[model samples]
Target: MKPLYRGLASATRRKASRFALETRLDAMTTRLKDVGEFGLIERIRRLLPGAPDVDVIVGIGDDVAVLETGGGSYLLATCDCQVEGVHFLWDTTTPFELGRKAAAVNLSDIAAMGGAPRWALVSLMAPQEILVESIEELYRGLGGALAEAGAVVVGGNTAKSSEGLIVDITLLGRVAPEHLLTRSGARPGDVAAVTGTLGDARAGLELWLRPESGVPEEEARTVKRRYTSPQARLLEGQCLGRCGAVHAMLDVSDGLLSDLRHMCEASGVGVELEVERVPVSPALPAVAAALKADALAWALTGGEDYELLFAVSEKDFPRVADQLLQETGTTCRAIGRFVDRDQGLRLILEDGRRSSFDAYAGGWDHFKAT
Candidate 1:
């Protein structure tokens, strides 16, 4: 007992000494809140910038890291995590739904790369008092989602979380060299398009948050399903890859505008989205109306749609969109066009007015004040 006390005391002293050192260096170091998530990513990228001169295929900035393995296919790897309070609440979310969502988000990353998912590693952290049966059901949901795309959960690690449940999954996939689309491939004049519709998932989230908004039960179900079970556009992505038409691509996990910003920055271009053309889900208007919200605003900044946002040459876009629809029974809409780097990101409103979109604002930031 004395030794244990001594060990704790030493640890406390070490922490205090480190705290003092940090205090001295405080002015030089910015807080996490100030940096935000993307800012921190930029800092980390600088510390370990991928090799120059084609040594690195795809580096830290994109959705999935692409690796060359001396084969016809490039390996795709991506991981995503969902926290209890930050991402969801047990009051509304089921363990099964949470598990399914966690897997689907990772699959969306692979889908963005136009890859076929093969394997997954799911790591989880839960409260010690969480029911073992609940964990089993969670795995059931996760495994079923993965299985739909021919992916299997091969292995994972488990830990006891102090507060909320956390599920992190690393998905592995492969894509043919010819079909491996990336965000950096977008070119000026490329017609930017998105698969399926937007705003539904965000509307679903709104319904959950504003239960008394009086949205009809059937309409609520439609939007809520979109939030809980996002179809990752895997088939549409594969079709686009095979068509040899898509120049660049990504999943709309971070809202159309924000993800478009990422693509523009990566491809060294600007864009102008036709606001009137942005596709809104059929159910979104009713939900937005019921909640007394601006439906257009929700579609613009609402993240987690998980639909595919892509670019193709204007001449090729029609054929590509048609092929995707015929092959996967999924539709796509061209809402924007890439432009000269100097133009920046702008939007054409219904009134024929053009305005610059401030990409850094009105989007989800993990560290930003909600």
Candidate 2:
């Protein structure tokens, strides 16, 4: 870790430039982009802290970091990135909100795996002109959310970005080998349950992005909070792990239907979602009514809700829900049940009609060209 700091000068050496660089023939120079993706990753690996001696198996260089406790559990680690204009619009979202959201989203992934988060590493790519005060405030906001989620910030990196603010959060969590939930474990007859209401964040996004609309200040503030600082159901996820009831799990970062379909496809099962069973946010309906948008559609297809969805055995459903309430004060409701692979993914409407729903596309894919 001491040697890692030696490369800090490389990050801070360059001054902001108005024109592209075209240096003298023999001068040593390298554009940040010219560092190349692999080289930049090597630099980041060099900068990260070494894993503690007691529990780490692999760290800093894999697609996902790993740590073994030798207690029949292994820690699985991963991170997520939120970029301004791409993941969000800074003008529409407050720095405090953005910070909380960036951290919350990563924690949500950990929760989706039925794991309890233990550590976090945040990296911010700040623009040259943003105020130092704003940056400090953002950390305060993120710190609050991380505390609430039962995780700690162990390390971070800061650098300048010419585009917009960038927040990348890495999370480390521990899960018992027998209790770890993954998309590939679902089986026919397993029941699907979600921890909370959905679509509020997506509806909130619409409200925050459009200011000319006549929404009340208090309502606006609430929606903005949801869009900016949504919480991850980490406690509930831990309860699910303790209950030993979950088979497959995933966070609803993308649309609910899309992510659910992902779990089913991964596990080689099909799902039948009861539309009436999908929890609706109390605030979403009113906001959607004002905007002439369909609340149900928003709840079904909206992303960034950060809720946990998991499949459980029908026999363990009652015990699981009761444990969740006792531990998290959040109800875990069954929304559907898994079916045979050949049956395929389908949705049951409130009117008692059923239809097949296939994906045209789902979630944010950064590599796609506009």
Q: Give TM-scores for every candidate, taking all chains together and pairing residue i with residue i.
A: 0.92, 0.79
Weakest 10 consecutive residues, lDDT, candidate 1? 1-10
What candidate 1 gets wrong by more than 4 Å, as runs, is 1-28, 49-55
Tens-place lDDT digits, model 1, residues 202-268: 9998888888889999999999899887878898888988899888999988888889989999899
RMSD of each: 3.4, 7.2
Off by over 4 Å in 2: 1-72, 215-221, 359-364
Which pairs clash in model 2? Answer: none
Compared to the true structure, candidate 1 yields what TM-score? 0.92
Instruction: Specify the highest-lDDT model's number.
Output: 1
Taking the tens digit of each residue's C-alpha lDDT, what string does model 2 give over 1-370?
A: 2346445777675776535445545257765556654467678878887655766554553334557767677888988898887898867767787788888888887887677788889998888899998888788888888888778899989887767889899988888776666666788999999988888888788987776667666666676677777888887777786777688778887788878877887788998999889997677777887788888887888878888888999998898888899888998789999999999988898899897765324444344343
Instruction: State the C-alpha lDDT per candidate.
Output: 0.88, 0.79
What is the model-wide C-alpha lDDT for candidate 2? 0.79
